[model samples]
Target chain A: MRKFINEPSKVAQETLEGFLAIYGDQFAQVPGTLAVAKRVLDDKVAIVSGGGSGHEPVWLEYIGPGFADAVCQGDIFAAPAPQSIVRAAKAVERGRGILFVYGNYSGDRLNFDLAAEELQAEGHEVLTVRVADDVAAAPPDRANDRRGIAGGFFVSKIAGAASEAGLDLKSVQELATLAADRTRSMGVASAGGTIPGTDEPTFVLPDGKMEIGMGMHGEAGVRRADMATADETVDHMIRLIVGDRSLSPDEKACVLVNGLGATTRAELLIIARRTAWVLDQAGIRIHDLQVGDFATSQEMHGFSISVFGLTPELQKLYDAPGRTSFFSGANRH
Target chain B: MRKFINEPSKVAQETLEGFLAIYGDQFAQVPGTLAVAKRVLDDKVAIVSGGGSGHEPVWLEYIGPGFADAVCQGDIFAAPAPQSIVRAAKAVERGRGILFVYGNYSGDRLNFDLAAEELQAEGHEVLTVRVADDVAAAPPDRANDRRGIAGGFFVSKIAGAASEAGLDLKSVQELATLAADRTRSMGVASAGGTIPGTDEPTFVLPDGKMEIGMGMHGEAGVRRADMATADETVDHMIRLIVGDRSLSPDEKACVLVNGLGATTRAELLIIARRTAWVLDQAGIRIHDLQVGDFATSQEMHGFSISVFGLTPELQKLYDAPGRTSFFSGANRH
Candidate 1:
């Protein structure tokens, strides 16, 4: 493996240690648990999210003001245990209750739900909103069954904003659900990433071929097709996202062109350029555009496009200042 | 050849177009020139930095309030022409002259110096400070002959901050030069990236081997050795930087662990963890720590470490609010 890792089995723990060393002033690990919680707490609803480890800057780096209050990280491509989730919730619970926001995946749902039940038994109010935004993961009739992907970024941003706005648990939960429902994403993979400690990649594609809608962990995508140009790939992904969201002309939306690991910022911008043109052609006014690595799959080479159709309320929350190790939404002075 | 580019020849232009499309509200292209100027120019000495285009977000994304007032972009892996540099300087000049800060490359030095002459002839004061902070590129006696690597980020940042504080052109230039002198960096590459419009990789490494002190564009490094673990690599890099800068116990410094291209954030944080430990062992206090892609060679699988020993004034300026598309320094609310 060409990675700078020491031991494959300890990569996840070391990654978290490294994160804390750099950002410990703003975030800290919950004692005896693989849960990272914000160093400062507010007397409002708490927002928590997490899943696997390899996708750095996802749930971990997103834990800060106007983002998740805590994150429970699992091992590479695995879900955090229920105990860790409960520990994270307990660390941030401020008596306004706790709301769980995360990508829609079976392991994540099972663990978070179990954690919710435990928190409820302890007399703490708990709610959950699973982001189901990957259009190619399921048909329209079963949208809720779709895997979440990069659109979970939107879900977390809005949810964290609502919580920061001092909304009650139920209200924050509702807004988070709405954000998840309105968001859609699709991704194409040029190459799969290798899990640490393994010499082989998670998956492989023949030269000159690409996979559409690949999951963050290299799960099978909708199909494998011959490689296409950046514009062509973005057009296809945008079509799937727009159609799945039933977005119409004259609507407003926030767009996120996310680079899966190994993709350059230049390529993301190129993808963003094509994305804006397509949205403009459809008369969809882009209220905000964010292009970067919000979520990633190790060193996987590809990108994902996410669109969050916005109501005025959602737009306001989305525009609110957010500060995180990975995503920064501060306005220029 | 697994990239999302449309045409390799148009990659640079399209990348700029994509950047403008997303950031048009804050920046604009100088008409008929490959120069991007901040939309709102201040009355202070203008800060301009640019070079080749492949390093997305380097000089282009750095153009904004509290950063570069303008940036002149050249084609991939080439310096901007003298005319473009002059054009960019004119776009942001407010009778307070211009301060040009960028990496020390022969091509860049030639063009920027030529532009400085032209701008001077037009009755505009101009100053230049070439960043030469790569310790591995030269011996101590010939430090000024060293290549500028990721440490240019610190130079632009301090220069931009100095200018934003309403310092005079010469004062800003002095502070920028001071920043350049105090900064040190070293990089290692496991694999090289392919340039746009080309099917061949820029350089190649045999399996399980890595190159130390590699240049941004895959220029030959100091040596090739068997790949080492993250901690060992970071130790060697930190030693070279500390020795070159003569960093001492109790000295405060800012750290930047920059990913070249394809390295994952997890790996970066892992590197950061070791970086902090090593510095701490030497009794060097970390004033600020930033781990991300400040400067990158497109899709190159490696990273660099930059340490900026901070003076009190420099530390204060570095902490001042600065926001760009890629960086944010607003205090958390």
Candidate 2:
């Protein structure tokens, strides 16, 4: 891959500078960190989220307006630092409180925890929501052992909606936790991503076979198997999601067919349509379905399926109005 | 390649159905086709543009509010029917008249011409602007033969800005034409896409080489060569765009480091930072810069850089804010 980076190490920092130039309006720079947050939330509970830097609009894209009060950005596939997390929380804290939501990575957990303590010390209430919705990352017994992937969207939407509903800090935290509990994601990778200027694949798969249940950073898949037809692949993912959720025949759900890094809209719709049919055949009702690159892997050639069991209450939050850079919709009101 | 589509033909229709279901309040269907427009502009010069289905948020995404009065959607990479185009134009046209801006393609040109005729017969005045900014698709003598790729952003932004300025029909049309003329694009492709249910790639490329200047549909590239580094690729493209436009060190331009399909944000910025630097070295100050899958070829692993020799006046229009489904920026006005 021919890349224009100064060095692989500087890629994330330089990119943050550019994003800050455009999105700096909604975010204030955190001292000594590559984090940004909303300019105002006086007395309002603040929601903070972060992950690797490769997913363009996922973490950072979901910030602003009714979403995260602030976001901490780290290098590609690397967690943000403790100082960064604390600064992000402080940057968006309006004194109502602060809550941190992040993928279930050890580094992210440690840093966010450290940040939580710092916020609490400052006389502000602070809570944390760890989103570990990836089913393939670990067994059900250790669901939280899985890494957070595209389910970040569900977490983001629900959290933003809860905050916008004028819920207090505890209520907001509970709402986010509830949504995270019900959501699950599974991903597959056709190819691995390359570090800028590097020629080696981050992970490898045999030609004509896909790494099912692949991680966003091209982590090893649960299995390497022959490339299945579209229906077969989708059916496998849908079955796992449906089986795990144990959706009743009349259950309602919201679906997201996410492109990791390089999947196309054409392919996304393919997943969306088939996934919808799978649900329809199972007599599951879909209130809303979105197909796009909501979460990506810097153009990795694979995708993930994310599902959230929804009720009239959760569905309303899922449909809540949002003003993200990529996705938008009406408020639950 | 797991997809959500049913019949190949139904992908566009069904996805649009979902779009309306999710965004019904912000948009209304165009009577019969997969096209839609904002409801308020029944009398403004309806600006309708579209090409294929997969590149969501492009034609339809740039629609709404201050951008396109309405948009027409074609079946993935297929130009919409004349009937659909006519209906879309009629629905969005205010007394100000209507103008259609789209890529320079035989299917698009044929259908848009027929739609213009259809509208004219009904006593609706209409005009068309053909975007031919792609530098890699055609030879210089056949400049009009070049295709429109990511440069569509430049075209759409200018049109919306002009219309929002309340320029008369002819003046707006001319401004759009000028904007289209001032832009050029060069793209690279890393992978190919599969239509839903199909096993074959829409197009194919050697694993170690890149299809330079490929169209957004996996069409043939201007050339296929060894994968160059990102800096080299950006440099190669800059040379072509500057040479074609005779841009000098003192010229001002806007840059779009557009993902062809599935390239990640991390990758886009990796290249975009270099793109910005390259332009800076040329003594060209970017009036604006955006990087993402503004135009794509499904999940292809490539991106394109579009340079628009924007004048201060044109840049103003480009910067105007409007809200669309896929993308929205506030107009500086």
Candidate 3:
């Protein structure tokens, strides 16, 4: 297909250069590793996160003062290598500590853990928070076996904000843990996204049918039912999420309705509207709402809804001000 | 044909409802109007803008503390009515003045002007800035008639920062003017975007073909050409943009490679990466870079690149800090 570049291989590198020029002011990058806080070597309780490229404002935008100190970007959806993770840790090597946050995928876990070990040997503080919020990645009883989705946004935001606000390394880790404990997310897809320079999708969807519980990276969801309206879709998703979480009717919550690459803001807003209506009718007070393409799936035509159960302290931190490419007002009411 | 909504009609309203609960805390209903903004009107100058719903994070994410004080969301790719624009202005009116900034479309202009006239009758100081940054809307001979694309982000940010930093309504208007003058954007579309709930696209593109200079609303580009590699496409678009603006080899500037809608971040990043390589080879001293779906055209698989030549003052404002739903660290470098 017609595209915008001279060579496919050169695309990623050039884009990174432009990305640096654009967001470089926001993060400090070490050649092989991730980008850390510009002056943030001061406090150790660090939070590092990453993923493959192509999910803009995801791994990178989520990196900043209030969230991840650094984020390692791999080639499109490819896991970053061990050296990159080690470099991310080295950049944020404050005496306090460092926490690596990411999905529970085999590639990410192995590399991040290896980076941690390498850093520990070098006498740098290190930790890792594996995000497994995607219920579709595993069976109901095997929730921990699930993969990560947009829920990474909430987890990373809380963790980064805590770290930037001067929480000690362990304390920051605990903050992400606490936040992650209260967070859950799931998605539905109408189509799959193709990797750049490749014609095949990660998977496939049937014509006139939709896939619910699809992972951000093309993992199959729990069901493939007949499609429905925006309201009906929201109802289906909310029912599943509420049933899983058993949320109280009166609890205040932060809600996120994200576009999975190909969904439009208009479509997303419609979904969010229906979600709020369905949610408000259930008496759940939505204290915050974020609707956009936060964590995309290449060009998949789908969306995911994530909820962050909040405590007062976590809420305060969620509302704190910070800088990043994607969000600075995560959960700010 | 699988999609994610119940009815097409109720989409925008629902989306705004969900948005209001979270990122929209800065906004409130304008009493019988569909527009929204912050409470207590912090600054005297209120910047208002909005149009079709599909271009998320544009008009919506732009309305906040440091950006436009109010936004008027419209139907999918349709302009907000006079009623909505009126609502937007009323909500945005903070006393210093109110300014309306939208694209050069007839619908947006007519409605905004009508709202301004009506608001003026009710005794409010209002100003207007119409964006015509798309070089293809009209020939360079009649650039004023060109359409506005995703470049609205740069214009809005610069103008909003100016207004928030206490520029008079006229000064803020001028800031937007200057930025728009220096900005030129062109795009390439791989596939077409489908209207939600509709099985067909507003337009169509043959597979393996590309349309150069397509509008944000899926309007046919100036020409459909064979798809090329990222660098080739970049060269084509840049030649047009550079020719239109007549930038000198030594001229410095910022660049944006934006997805029309369904263009993957990985794809866009690759595009951005390659574009940077080309400019670097030409010895172009790029000042900044923005890559993503800044202004989208639903799920259309395409991208647009915008270059904004900066003056010192414009650069400073471009680098200033602001917090909002879609962006942060949207400040000067």
For every prediction, compared with the true complex, DockQ reads: 0.61, 0.33, 0.54
> Considering every candidate listed, which one attains the maximal lDDT?
1
CA shift of B114, model 2, Å: 4.4
**Global CA lDDT computed for model 3:** 0.76
- The superposed Cα distance between candidate 2 and the true structure at residue A2, in angstroms, equals 5.6
**Local lDDT at B192 for model 1:** 90
> Model 1, B1-333: lDDT tens per residue?
688889888888889889888888778898877789987877899999999888877767887667899999899989999999999899999999999998888999999999999999989999999998888787889876788889898888899999999999999999989899889999999989889767687899998999999898898888998999999999999988898777766568889999999999999989999999999988898888888898899989899999999888888788887777867772222
**Candidate 3 lDDT tens digits, B131-227:** 7888766798888789998777778878888987888888888898998888888877888787766889767888788888888877877998888
Candidate topping DockQ: 1
For model 2, what is the error of residue B29's alpha carbon versus the real structure, in angstroms, after optimal superposition? 6.5
How many clashes in each candidate? 0, 34, 33
- Consecutive 10-residue window with the lowest summed lDDT within model 2 chain B: B324-333
Query: lDDT, candidate 2, residue A76?
Result: 78
**Top candidate by TM-score:** 1
lDDT of 1 at A83: 95
Model 1 chain B scores worst on lDDT over the 10 consecutive residues at: B324-333
Alpha-carbon DockQ of candidate 3? 0.54
Candidate 1, residues A187-263, lDDT tens digits: the string is 99889888887768778999889999999999899999998899999888888888777776656888999999999
Q: Put down candidate 3 lDDT per residue, A172-194, tens digits, no spaces.
A: 88888887878888899888887
Q: Give me the displacement of residue A289 in model 2, in angstroms.
A: 3.5
